[model samples]
Target chain A: MMEEGVKKFLYVNRKAPYGTIYALEALEVVLIGAAFDQDVSLAFLDDGVFQLTRDQNTDGVGVKNFSPTFRALGDYDVNKLYVERESLEERGLTADDLQEIVYEDEDDDWAEKPSIRIISRAEMADLMHDQDVILSF
Target chain B: MSTLHTVNKSPFATQSLLSCINHVKDGDAILLIEDGVYGAAAGTGVSDAVAGKAGSVKFYVLGPDLEARGIPATRLLEGVEVVDYAGFVGLAVEHDRAQAWL
Candidate 1:
C-alpha cells in the first residue's frame, strides 16, 4: 500500500483504447487510487494519443467508445492528464484538438483543480524524477 | 539509471520484446513476466536474442511464471535469476523506472 500523504503515482497510459485491456485497466488503477485519496497523475504518449482523439469510431469495431470516459476524471477528482507534445504533433493534435479540458503545457498546480497538464519529453523526465510510483499501461 | 522492463508477450510475436532489446541499456536488468517467461527457453528464439543481449542486459524471470511454465531458471543461461512476484515488486522498487512492453 502507498503511504498516506507521500503516496504519489504517475500512471502513464501508453496504449490505444481498443488494442488491449491496458487502457481500461489503467483507468481502473487510477480510480482505485483516487478512492484511497492518493496523489495521482496521468501522462499519454505514443499510440496512447489515440485514446484522447476525437471522433473515435469504435462502433464499427463493435466496441464502446472509451474516449469520453476520460471526461469523468474531473468528477472523480482525478484530473492530472498530461499528453506528450511531440506525440500530439506527430498525430496532428494540439491541446485544443482534445474535446475535453486539458492543458497545453505543464502546470503541476492549478487553482482549485488538479493540473490536467501537458509537457515535452524533458519535462516528462522531470515528472518521472519526482514520482514515488509510476505505472505504464 | 535502473530499469525493470516487464514484457507481456513473446520476443518475436510482439513488438514489446524488440523494443526492450533495443532500448534497455547495458547493466539494466530485464525481468521476464507474463508470457515473457516463455522466452527463457534455451535454444528458443527468445533465448538466442537474450543471449545476444549478454553484455547489454541481464535476463530474469518471475519464478511463479517459470514454475507454471515448468522451465527451471538453471536450465537458462548461467546468469538468469528465478525471482518471485514479491521479488518482482522489489525489482520495481529497486529500479528507477519500469517500461511495460505489452
Candidate 2:
C-alpha cells in the first residue's frame, strides 16, 4: 500500500471558530484538498481547539455551525487531527470537551477508532517539522 | 463609581487582558468574554499577575464562552467567578459605567 510521490500536507489551524472566517475557510480548504489524496494531517492549537468543542449553536449569531463537517472528514481520509495538549491546558480544556470524531480502520478489520489525538506542544513541533507542506491559518 | 471592564481577546494572543488588568481600579470588575476566557485558567504565566490584582479588582469570566471553549469552571484560577449571560447583564447594570478594552 505504498504510493510514489505522495507528499505530507499539514494544515495548522490556530483561530477560534465564528470569531473570524479563518477557521471556516481553513476547514473548506482541507475538505477540498482531500480530493488530491495527499497524506494529510490537521493540527489544532491556541484557540483552534474551540472549533471542535461540542454543542456549538450558531442560531443566535445567524451563522451556520460548520463544526459538524469535521465529523465528515473521516470520510475523506483526512482523519489525523492532532490537538496540542499545552494549548488545551492553557485554555482550561480537556479532550473530553471536544466533539467525538471516529474513523474506521480499513486495515484493522474495519474497526472504529477515534480520529483526534492529543499531543504535546513539542510533539506538535516535531510533527510540523516532518511535514512536506504546512499551511497555517 | 464602579466600572465593569470587558475583554474579548486572549491573553496569550494579545495585550488586551493584561492592559485591562493594569488599568482596573479597586471595586471594578473585569469580565473575560470570548477568547479572553483563556486568561482565567490556573498556573499560567499571567496567573500571578491576575492574582496580584485579585485583592483590588474582582475577576469574572463568561460561562457560555468558557463552556464553548471547553474550559471547565474547576480549571479557573482561585476566586475567578463564572457568570452566566444574565449575570453579565447584571454586572453591566450594577456598575456605574461599562468599559470595553479593545
Candidate 3:
C-alpha cells in the first residue's frame, strides 16, 4: 500500500541518448528519486525510446554505456516504464529493438514481469494526466 | 482537461513540434517558445499540419522569441496568436498541465 505522503511522480524522457546529456541525466534523477519511496513512473516517447535499445556500444563515441543501468532499476523499486507505441513506430523501431527490462512482483510470489509497457499516444496522454507531478527531461 | 504544450525547437531541425502535434487533444493549446517560434510562421512545410488543427487547438508564439529571431508578427499563420511572458504564465495557469516538447 502507498503511504499517505507518497506522491505520484512521472519522469518524461524525450531526447535521444549520447547526442546530449539529457538521457543520462534523467536516468540519474530517477535513480536518486527512487530513494524517496515515491510512486514513480517513467514515460519514454519520441527519441527517448532510443535509450532502451539493446546492444549499445559506446566505445566509438568514447561514452560510457549506461543502458545496462536500466535493468538495475527493478532492484530500486523503480519500475512501470511506459514506452509510446506511436513514437516507436514513427522511428521504425519495435519492442524487439529495446532491451529486456523486468521487475519482480512481490505480491505474486515475487514473480518476474516485464517492466516496459508499450502504450499508445492517447494512453500516454492519459498517463500524463494521472500524475501528481510531472518532470520532463 | 486541457494541456499547454510548449515546443522549443525548430520544426526543420527536429521532430519535437510534429511529435507534439500528434499527441495533443482537441481542447489542448500549443505554445511556441525559443526556436519553436519558427513553427508559427506561415507557408512552411509543416504549416498545413498546424493549420488543420487550428479549430480545436489554440496555437501561440512567444513575442520576444519571434522578435529575437527577426520574425515579425505579421509573418505568423492566420490563426496563430502572439503571447508575451505574462501570457505564457497565464496559459500555464489556464491549462491543467504544461508539457514542454524538448
Candidate 4:
C-alpha cells in the first residue's frame, strides 16, 4: 500500500531508445520509484514512443533488447503508462504497433486489464502540470 | 517553490547544459552530475554562462562525480556548492520538483 504522503511522479521520455541511454535509464528509475510506493506515471512523447514499438529485434545490433522488460512493469505496480497520440501519429505508428501491456488488479479480484493508456497531447500537458516531480529524458 | 534541475551531460559533448541554463527560472537550482560536472570547472568555456546566473539561481555540483572525474573542488567556479548524494536528496525535498536534463 502507498504511504499517505506519496507524491505524483511523472517520467517524461522524449528520446528514442538505443541511440542514447536515456530510455533504459528512465526505465530503471521507474522501477526503483515503484519499489518506494510512489505514485508513478510514465509519459511517452516525441521519439520516446519508439521505445514501445512491437517486434524489436536486436539480434543484428547485438544489444540486450530490454524492451520486453516493460511487460514486467505491471508486477511492480507501475501500470500507468501513457503514450501520446500526436507522437504516435507523427511517427507513423498506431497503438496496435506497440506491445500490449496488462496488469492484474488485486482490488478487482485480480482481473486482468490493459495497462497502456493512449492519451492526447493536451491531456499529457495537463498531466505534466499535476505532477510533483517531473523526470524528463 | 523552486525547481532542482539536474544535468548529467558535458557541455562540450552536447547542448544539454546550455539548454538547461536557458530554462532556469529565478530562485531555481541547478545540480551538475556525471559529465555535467565539467561545466563547473574554472576554465571551461561554459563557466561564464554559469557565472552569469550567480545571483538569481543557485548552482551545485555533485562532489562524488567531481572526485570521480578528477575535478578538485577548488577548481570549480565561484559560488558553486559541492554536494553529496544525501545533499542531492535534500535538495529534491527542498525544491518543488526535479527536472533531469538528459
**lDDT value, residue A79 of candidate 1:** 70
Per-model chain B TM-scores are: 0.87, 0.97, 0.97, 0.97
lDDT of each: 0.73, 0.86, 0.92, 0.87
Candidate 1 residues lying further than 4 Å off, grouped into runs, are A1-4, A57-62, A85-97, A103-126, B1-3, B18-28, B37-58, B61-100
Best-to-worst lDDT order: 3, 4, 2, 1
- Ranking according to DockQ, highest score first: 3, 4, 1, 2
Model 4 lDDT per residue over A1-137, tens place: 65888989889887888998999999998888788888989988778899999999899997879899999999999899999998899789999999999999989999998889999877775676567889898
- Model 2, CA-based lDDT: 0.86
Candidate 3 similarity to native, TM-score: 0.93
TM-score of chain B of 1: 0.87
TM-score of chain A of 2: 0.97
Off by over 4 Å in 3: A1-3
Tens digit of per-residue lDDT, candidate 4, span B1-102: 678889999999876777567656778899999999999988778989989987899999999999998988889899999999999999989988778878
Clashing pairs in 3: none
TM-score of every model?
0.62, 0.59, 0.93, 0.62
Candidate 3 residue-wise lDDT, A1-137, digit = tens: 77899998999999888999999999999999999999999999999999999999999989999999999999999889999999899899999999999999888999999999999999997888777777888
List DockQ for all candidates: 0.21, 0.02, 0.50, 0.25
Clashing pairs in 4: none
Clash count in backbone of candidate 2: 0
Best by DockQ: 3
Compared with the true structure, what per-residue lDDT tens digits does model 1 show for residues B11-97? 667656654675566567888887888777787766667788866777888888878878876677666778887888898888877
List, residue by residue over A1-137, the lDDT tens digit for candidate 1.
56657677788776878879899888877877777677778878766777887777777888878777787777566778877887788778887776665322225454354344668866765565566677878
| Model 2 lDDT per residue over A27-89, tens place | 999999999999999988778889999999999999999999999999999989999888799
